[model samples]
Target: MSGLPAYSLPCQSERATLVSALLLLLSWLATPALAQDLGTNGPTYAIAEPHLLRDLQHRLQAKQASGELDTLMARSRERAIASVRDPQPIEGVAATRTPRTFYYDPTFTLDRNVLDAQGQLLFAAGTRLNPLDVVSLSSHLLFFDGRDSRQRDQARRLIAHYEGRVKPILVAGAYLDLMQAWRRPVYFDQHGRLTRQFGVTQVPALVSQDGARLRIDELETTQ
Candidate 1:
């Protein structure tokens, strides 16, 4: 219910579009000679701490060794407030198998068939989901509106926090009724019996209920 954070640039701008552009320029200006000294990725720099250019420059200086940037910092965490870790080589660890569970959002992507053989994804648009099959993960979700300074800061922290534990899936959704307002097509339509059965009425709803407790759910805001 609170306002989403305002992004510093136009909403049309990429999440790190500005930074990417800068990197491209820097890469060009310091190519070949510096690039070799810096490694294949070059001496990387990332916004850090305060999430601003100045802060990033400060961190870069502190992190740089002489005229050479730190190898680790330059490659993975460069210019990113967060550091991306290389996957640890598993020594003798064996993979374990688990039962496949369905994770779905009508507004999001689902693998293979989101619908069952019965042709129901959840319920017909007008129908309400049964209480048994859904688990609300909204409390665990974060939103980035890019309007509020606080949310912008939070977004940075959130991105860093989930750096590699889970890959982030970015998609846009709208209230089912306002699907047309989206710049692109909505992911799914709840017009069938299944959608009706779930009684879905909102856009951007994420339902992760179990078989016994299906229901429409909204993500809790993490601003």
Candidate 2:
């Protein structure tokens, strides 16, 4: 009060408040411009609609007219037959046997339930499955790269050998349509689940249950 200019404390507080209000107003005014810039810079996307039936019919007609379908079917049949013939004993590079004692936990709550194709309840929610409850449902899986003719042939032979005795699954193969054309009732591993679960890194590998353990055998194609 003695040396400084005479200023009211309330007046200074009002000035500070006014400055803060102005800054807030300026920030609010800039928000719309910032949003417009982002909108202009962002990517745009469009939905795609495909005519599957029309395309399939066109392809079928073209193949039928060109006589390629018959040729493909014949080649596929020959390959299927070749796979089963001249069964060469698999030459093993290594054999691994591991215990298959894995347990399954219910991932869903009681409110969630599993249904069948006909909307029938397959399993109620909160249903837990033990290791013994799923032992009989285990399947023998066959792993192969499918690009190699030798491996395909070996896989086919193995399928033929275990026909009716085991369910054969194809891993890392060519198109499923091509396999179906061969008239083999084999299933393809679309997601690489079996390969990843079993740590299979080699082609022409066979996985079968040995007592309470899984026996994984990696085989080589003989020249």
Candidate 3:
């Protein structure tokens, strides 16, 4: 009150705090720089290792010089050919050891609106439909393992019995070789898609249209 005008005087506590902060700031500014450089505790050396890309390139060069790269490439090419010629057999699907017959209803409900090329809604969402109503299975599907002679023979017999109305579909083994041998378009069920769709879990299975539903007959054959 005595030092400052009554209107200019703020609270004593706030004024003291402000003065203290200014003093602390001045003290800090008056103090010398305190940054210390504690040198490395252990020995240090320049990086001797090559860059990752350079190292990889060197290793690749070494492999190429040894003809290892060529071998790896050839092996990769063989694997690729093998995969296309004979894809990995579907797991849990074995040669028909147990005879079983089942039916699959091809009816499905639309989860979303199906549109035509013009973006016009062809079928609204939640609509139930059967594919058989529009187009029936043109040929009966004969699913079997081409690797087994018995199954191949069975497929051939079935194809002949069906009067060449059967489409030989392979669950495993070389499809191209079978196609050439059978002189027809031998289809391979890539990843057992058709089998899973039809609920077929075994080989030597015959799939035929039984009206609106598909009849799957998993037959047992001798070794």
* Tens digits of lDDT, candidate 3, 134-222: 99999988888889999888888888988999999888899999889878999888877888888888889988899999999999875
Q: Which ten residues in a row have the lowest lDDT in candidate 1?
A: 87-96
TM-scores of all models? Answer: 0.18, 0.39, 0.73
lDDT of 2 by residue, 101-207 (tens): 33223222455787999999987988754443356436666766555667667766776787745445555444354456667566655456666666665556677
Q: By TM-score, who's the top model here?
A: 3
Model 3 lDDT, full chain set? 0.82
Native-vs-model 2 lDDT? 0.56
**Lowest-lDDT window of 10 residues in candidate 3?**
20-29
Error of 3 at 216 (Å): 0.9
Q: Clashes in each model (backbone N, CA, C under 3 Å)? A: 49, 0, 0
The candidate maximizing lDDT is: 3
Identify the runs in model 2 with alpha carbons over 4 angstroms from their true place.
1-134, 137-139, 164-168
- Candidate 1 structure quality by residue, lDDT tens digits, 133-177: 344433222222222344334434654675522212112222232
Cα lDDT listed for each candidate: 0.37, 0.56, 0.82
